[model samples]
Target: MAEEETELSDEQKKEIAKWFLLNAPAGEIQYVAKDLKSVLNADDVYNEAASEAFPVYNKSHMICLGMSGHFGDVLVTSYGELNENEYLDPKTAQVAIVDHVKQVCTEVRPATDEELPSPYIEEYRCALEAEMLKYVSEAYPKGVCSVYCINGKDAEGPGSDFELVVVISAARLSPQNFCNGSWRSIWNIEFKDDIQSLELKGKLQVGAHYFEEGNVQLDTKHECRDSTIFQSPDDSAIAIASVIRHHETEYLASLEESYLNLPDTTFKDLRRKLPVTRTLFPWHNTSQFSLTREISKELGIGK
Candidate 1:
């Protein structure tokens, strides 16, 4: 039955490819065919099948499969290598980054008079409050035009470290000016040193922040921080965008050199070499439930 289903899917894919070839522009037929080939060549369907068949597959396999499938082995390989060299492999560096972020992000618990208190919850709350206060003070000394903080867990899901989101209202900050200069300058200043200076015992990962402009007018001195997490709150989007754009351009210029260094192979071979799994959705896997529960416990929440 499974074999029949697989055959049917392949047939359907072929039919779709034929339809695309006939309907698409004559000049674009090759491109469409290439895309179809890539999709059919993907290893995700096989990995998914294997995962469904074997419930005991480990987390590393799942993560590798999912990330490698979705992002491609080249991207995963590059990112993994970069992560190892830049943050993971070096114990000292990894510790420094994690510790730095934790230190800067950690907060002393505020005293409370409530009876039957939960110390864990209190500590977590204090840490969050401190992080919020610190960022607000550093970025908006006068007071935030707006503030949005959502409590969540890290990318690895519930048992992972806290994911604290702090979105400061940039209504009062001049979007144009920030889009022009301040954002870029700040990112360049903090990007490397801050992460390098940290002394902790874990990997440090950062994501970029996005900006949305509305009706509020921003002051000239402030702007929305650029998307990079490692960038300082004072960094402006305009400068960072320009810098990133330039960097990409430069990177592309060296693609030929990079490509020459890689081995020539078909997409299918690459896909098989790197299976796919859903690593980003950690909650989807039941195996990690215990870890999640532990995280909740740490946060002083009911298991």
Candidate 2:
């Protein structure tokens, strides 16, 4: 990455500058600085707005606007950094910053196919999945796991990153309480090799439903008790555990505020917390894609 930095040419800088200028507001002076740090992609327009001692509107503010789309009203404010000297009034800063940004802005298009998948990302996903699968099979003899190659299109839109959903089934455990208790014991069997190095992804809800004779609904969390890893590899245990831990940590961190508000809680609340449907499963992705395509077709944007 460092070596690649030296190869960036004056033409590339001018191109970035052009993008900045086009996206700038109707009136602004565009100042092109060579050593600006990009907040997103390395090759994308860089931001030099922070380099000055005091906030002065510059070409970098235009770059920021171009990176963040112009459809919605955007307000940029400077909050006091660790140092107290960096404070700026939010309202005044918002207007001045936006005006400055508009003055030096340029239009930028979404990334093309050539820039979508970097070599490192493609290799990382492939290698990670393979290693996860092998680890699961070797460690958990009674459990089963499988991996599927997922295209970004069937879930989110084209610009979305590739996603992996893993499902695991253990014969000795029930699915309802599977994630709740003794997760470490289960993971011990699932990931016996280099567990720390593995980049666990996310947890998923996997289950099925049934109807009774009179059409009464039966809610069974572990409807499939066959002890088969139907969708993903057992190594997904790591990812699921990680997500659960994160959620717990976040919940605990907010406990003080939650406790303070508990006394005011009312019965029969209208607000919803979790989504009604299980969003982690493949079926949700299919439904979402179908709905999206239908909407796009209605809008005459379907390909």
Candidate 3:
């Protein structure tokens, strides 16, 4: 009889598959993603677990994780370089940015019942809005807006301290449109004292917000409709959208001298077509647009 082959479990195969995918050349993620299916001998299991859980990461892929994690699509921003010690590696920056947002959303929040808006979130919101106001660029174009300062991030290494602020912005849309939701974007920028570096990388980010009562929301994925809620009409919707959009715009601009590299990402502003929902606060009516989520990102800020 012929010798039989051993089949790896989905988890086991996915571990190996991740390595292959990471090492795969640019634009070959889809092609490499299939190796797990063959190794596992359980297509259904791989599909259920490993298919969407691909964590094949590199410096080229950054900024994909959103602050809220559920609202905006994981988007890619431009690539750039700074000094070595003061360097900006997209992969490390992505980890730092995503982790910072994760921390801000949950760790910083309304301390007392009387807390209006989170103090932490408000600071960044104000500072970020001020920067966006400087530009009449397409994304921020003159409009009544809202800013959610997700939080302030600071990393102290051997030679330098990296301070990053993560925020989301939204710009108003027409009240005439029944599905009124603002266009949104997320951003992260390193606050370098003098700024230096010449290395480069790319990043993508998406966001989501779920509540854990006193703490930040534990999860944003709603397993059941009744247990979760999404609300807000157009007025609140557009403000929400602009805030998220502003985040990335400001982040990208901060990394470069100007907007030349913005074309690869969210340079385009489109609040009119964006579907919106309040992921954290109860706006008015619940929103259920799958492609969009409204966090009111103020959960941890201005409280």
Candidate 4:
């Protein structure tokens, strides 16, 4: 007689999904979501359901564990990166869909308060400020902004040992945005940073405060780099000009390359669209060492 195969129950399937959600390897969930999206698009059998999950998981196939839904329809209340260490904790057990055929997890939204470890939940609070500070500082490092980090003991909980406060010019990005509880509109972070108080011992806690006009303090207490050079937005333009004049040969060549094979536009129009310029011209160099007028003349713009 042939051995009988035991069919798994819905509860058993859910348990399997939870296990995979907590134990799947890094990037596996995202890859599976991508693969399922391709499958859904190619196959007409699975009814396409609109999703409000992260942009990456949109239109992907899923098997909802909590609700009755179609192939592509699943309510993802929240999601986050699976921490294997938290697998033992029952509260960390998540109710989500899984791709049993592929034996992988599909998607997990941002970590809900109940899902994360006690120590990590507090640190996650400052996620928005941290990301925005990183983005602005990197995008406009030419003195457009400054990042100040402070290291301190976590007075309230043993989980954290430091506090991070960020300051930025309201002209660049308003502070209200951070305080508004609308992080998704600002930027979508795929994986959040893990705050370890021990590793931050030699590191600096960068912070930003909103400032308006005039000169502001750039006294960043970071251990890695000096952020004092970032004084003001206007000064950044001057600094850019100085650096270009200092490296005139190489930069000018790069600038010419950027301008080549492009449609002709007026100097005013070009200056207006300088943000999208393929090359950074010395727009602030107006005194003795200046390329503003020369470049304009070269571009066939009249005085």
Q: Using TM-score as the measure, which candidate wins?
A: 3
Which model is ahead, 1 or 4, in terms of TM-score? 4
Off by over 4 Å in 1: 1-122, 145-162, 173-303
lDDT of 4: 0.31
Q: TM-scores across all candidates?
A: 0.17, 0.19, 0.27, 0.18
Candidate 3: where is the Cα deviation over 4 Å? 1-12, 24-28, 35-40, 48-120, 129-163, 166-303
Predicted candidate 2 versus true structure: per-residue lDDT over 98-134, tens digit per residue: 3342332232233333323244333433444455455
200-274 in candidate 1: lDDT tens per residue? 111111112223463222112212222333222233222333443444335434544544644535444554434
| CA lDDT for candidate 3 | 0.33
Ranking by TM-score: 3, 2, 4, 1
User: In candidate 3, what are the lDDT values of residues 12-118, reduced to their tens digit?
Assistant: 66566556655543233444556645765666665544333333232233223333333322222222212111112221121112222111222111123222223
Output the lDDT of residue 88, model 3.
Answer: 22
What is the per-residue lDDT of model 4 for residues 8-30, given as tens digits with 9 covering 90 to 100? 55455444443433332222344
Displacement of residue 265 (Cα, Å) in model 3 is 34
lDDT of each: 0.29, 0.32, 0.33, 0.31
Clashes (N, CA, C under 3 Å) per candidate = 25, 16, 59, 18
Where does the lowest 10-residue lDDT sum fall in candidate 3? 219-228
